[model samples]
Target: MSAPVSTGVIPELFRGLFDDAAVFPPGNLPVAEAVPAHRVHRTAWYAEAVGPLLCGAGRLGELAAVPPTSGAVGGAQEAGATPLRVGLVLPGGSAELAPALAAAAPFELAGVELATRDAAEAVAELDRLLPPHVPAAVELPRELLRGDGLDAVLDVLVDSPYRAKFRTGGLVAEAFPDEDELAAFLTGCALRGLPYKCTAGLHNAVRHTDPETGFEHHGFLNVLLAARETDRAAAAAVLAERDGEVLAKAARSLTDRQVTVIRNSFTAFGTCSIAEPLGDLAALGLLSSPDPLPQEDR
Candidate 1:
């Protein structure tokens, strides 16, 4: 029998979350509203954007949170809370990123993900530039790694002159490529024991089954699951071969619709709660709690 098909909730690689200054899902309840959740990770907005949700109402529970260094270091009470990670963004093609990170001290930088246009060159630069203490992710085209070319694509990104200086991480290229490349990248990452995370064009959670309608969902969940349990060959087969069962079996355990927990203002959940300093985002998502924000402020 053909491999089971995926539920389409997850992609075959990492989840590519888009940058948004604010989000409103057309609901009165604050159950699902995030502002600049993944994007605009500046610091000034944290106390207002994240203070309340994480420190005000209650703990958002255990969850994966990438607290932007710019947004978190303000010493908010919730700052001491448990966190999945504290991440920083490095601009693509930047040579100064490594030095800047090294200069900063006492910041428990869990990991860093940088955006780059050229995967091979970016990885090489990071290898030469990055300090061994830091774990970095080199962005490659998600579509390429998810297919047959995953191995070759990674081979180019890693295995460079400075390859040994840096550890293996996910590929984060912009826009998906053909199935061959995409499958190859994902499978290669898994084989190497690297965790791949994606960015951009994956704000939602469904594949564009109906491309004519111009509707598509994110594929983050799909990629992560398939990579974790399956081997490079198996994952490649599942993605390239279109044997849905192989992908589906893994997808079911990885994707979840639960509310994102709060870590900081620029965090996935903290931005949703409209805490002090960042309540302005509530306007974008249609909020209905506490007093109404001033019209001028909105």
Candidate 2:
């Protein structure tokens, strides 16, 4: 359902908190199809909660073929009338990055997400590839924590304009990080004052095991609240919370100061379906209206 204009009821901390990832797994919508759907979402009443359409670096040619300023794939606005802001997901140290960025130069480049095994190498590549105006979030293999790579990567990112990212879930069971790993990641980021983003398996607002995949997924609310906390123990407790009511209450309890810190530190997450989270928000009584029209009605 679409949310009404903000009346200061919904926390400002959540505006633009969900980046549309319809082109990704589960959804796997065609780029052309996703583009129009995203344009519609941008104009919806709850549009404030949505961010850029995320596309992979490998699909630069497909993105480039779409008219840069097209209003929507099949809408009233004339083609090339409104430019699309796209987030490019790049493989770790992909040599195609330079060329991909050049290919999509006609549109607004929202940000970049890189997956690398070596944090140090990722940092160096980011320096070489990322434009100052464009922000980047690097995801290092969780296994890197076995050595000093995680520490070294955090050290460099601590002072840089870029941020870090964590994979919250994926297609495989092993893709989900255990509590200890997630706790360490959160603790590390807070300790270093490093802001971060999350991606995958956060379709719902509360942690739950997906019956279809039997993989336990984390809640975006849990992570957001965890980021608000500086104490590692307290944050870990929040991360482990699975009760939606408890999580909702904790979210509502946040003071303006806490909200500011949480939003700044945690930033936005990528979700394949915007509707799922928005629906959850409505169910939790967090939206402007509990029974707003469904997205299709808009």
Candidate 3:
């Protein structure tokens, strides 16, 4: 519930940008291990860049079984550590929402993301069941992006409390959206002023093809830069850019207002490994390595 802790090391553009998705693939870190690791992240030097620990709705019971650790939900707690802040991920759609919320009774619920084919149904279910205080992002099926289906869903979401979520990558190559498709999504959201989040496939900060899988992955920086553009073609070009230095220069040139406008639309993204992205930012000279934390804090 509290804002992410900023140590003045991470820039405004990236604060609370990387949601911890360790329990999801291709990392698939176990819940027991993830809980403690998440606590460590909350206290780390770059805590400002981190977001909630995301757990699937089906695995809330597993997450619940993990014992509490010393860190607070969003940052270090002086009074004593509190329950971990987590975003519940319901891959099974709105059908599992009610039960998921009930199951998530123990943790500090930061938000919820659910995948759904029926946008109307998902919207109605969220209206009927989801808590108003809890933010929700409905993941639109990829097929919707190609048709008027995206507009139909956006129309409903524009007036509602919920936002949009897009899947950037998954286990297979088909899961990653090409530049044009992602461009349309970005432009559409920008046109509507709809906030959205991305999940999977954003392995590093710059756009690059994975050597192992040969899958062309979108860089999170590329997405950020792309989100700033309202023109679909221009946005697509940003998404397709593979030069790390170019991307870093663009990122460094962003004024505070530009950073706010970009982040307002793109929100946060789910990443399996926080270290990888942190390393990428440091390598780009966007983030400086903070001095080691005091031994007591560690």
Candidate 4:
């Protein structure tokens, strides 16, 4: 199902910005439970702020086993309700995309994200197999980020229909790209006019170091602001900014056209916990609090 359009209080900069990643990483929510929780999110007052539920290609069988009635909420019947929208992640690369697409026929296939060492080969496969209407994001191998390989991939993507995907954080500290590297990526895509999405580790709206793991995390809001800067150094500066009020002030001051331009390139980021980012935005005054759910729904 297409995401419900945003209205009322949520700002234009944030609509459909947080793609649900509860099924992956630390959350690791089972597909059965995630389905019902996603239903609750879709039916909530803040539904517009949410995006498709992401599921790995290897886990489609687990998702397929979820009972039909598992998604029903608020007295709604499953028979006539919209199928859950899902973004398929192909970590095994394009080889797994075909069968994964077939398995995902049961849901609304929002998009595809595939990681590959060969950008050229992946683009060729995507061209041959991907439905024209379904968007795909090619994840360039991290090894390529610091070398000529990055440009080679960008060159291919510049001429293809697919966008780019970047990994911003992971389980270990080494997985998180430093401000300079991330700045280069933002600037690189901007130079080519290629839109991109981020996955993993963007747990909040501002940059900070995790006290438990000592990992320096990139903030989704910093990314939003960084995407708007043309200079690599300026972009890096934005990415490294840690003050919440400064980031919030910068975010609040964005003109409508500026927001459009920023979102056009930055797109969306997958977040494991929707409430964390939503709460951050609310605390920043960028988003108003959503109405409380009834006792039963709560």
Model 2, 70: alpha-carbon shift in Å? 7.3
Report the error of model 2 at residue 203, Å: 1.8
Total clashes for model 3: 0
RMSD of 3: 3.6
Give candidate 2 regions above 4 Å deviation. 1-10, 67-80, 92-94, 146-148, 290-298
lDDT of 4: 0.84
The lDDT for every candidate, in the order shown, is 0.35, 0.76, 0.85, 0.84
Model 2, span 87-142: residue lDDT tens: 88886355656877887676677898888776666677778877889988988767
- State the lDDT of candidate 4 residue by residue for 1-298, as single tens digits: 3346455767889888889898898788877778777776766777888888899988877776766654342222266656778899999988998899888887778899999988889999999998899998999768787767777778899899988999999999999999999998898888888999999999699999999999999999999999988789999999999999999999989999999999999888888788888888888888886585312211
CA RMSD, predictions in order? 13.9, 3.7, 3.6, 3.1
User: Candidate 1, which ten residues in sequence have the lowest lDDT sum?
Assistant: 258-267
Better of 1 and 3 by TM-score: 3
Better structure of 1 and 2 per lDDT: 2
lDDT of candidate 1 over 16-86, digit per residue (tens): 12122122221112212222232222222221221211111111211113232433322222444322223
Clash pairs detected, candidate 2: 69-80, 70-80
For candidate 3, the per-residue lDDT at 248 reads: 96
> How do the predictions measure up, each by TM-score?
0.42, 0.89, 0.93, 0.93
lDDT of 3: 0.85
Summing lDDT over every window of 10 consecutive residues in candidate 3, give the lowest-scoring window.
69-78
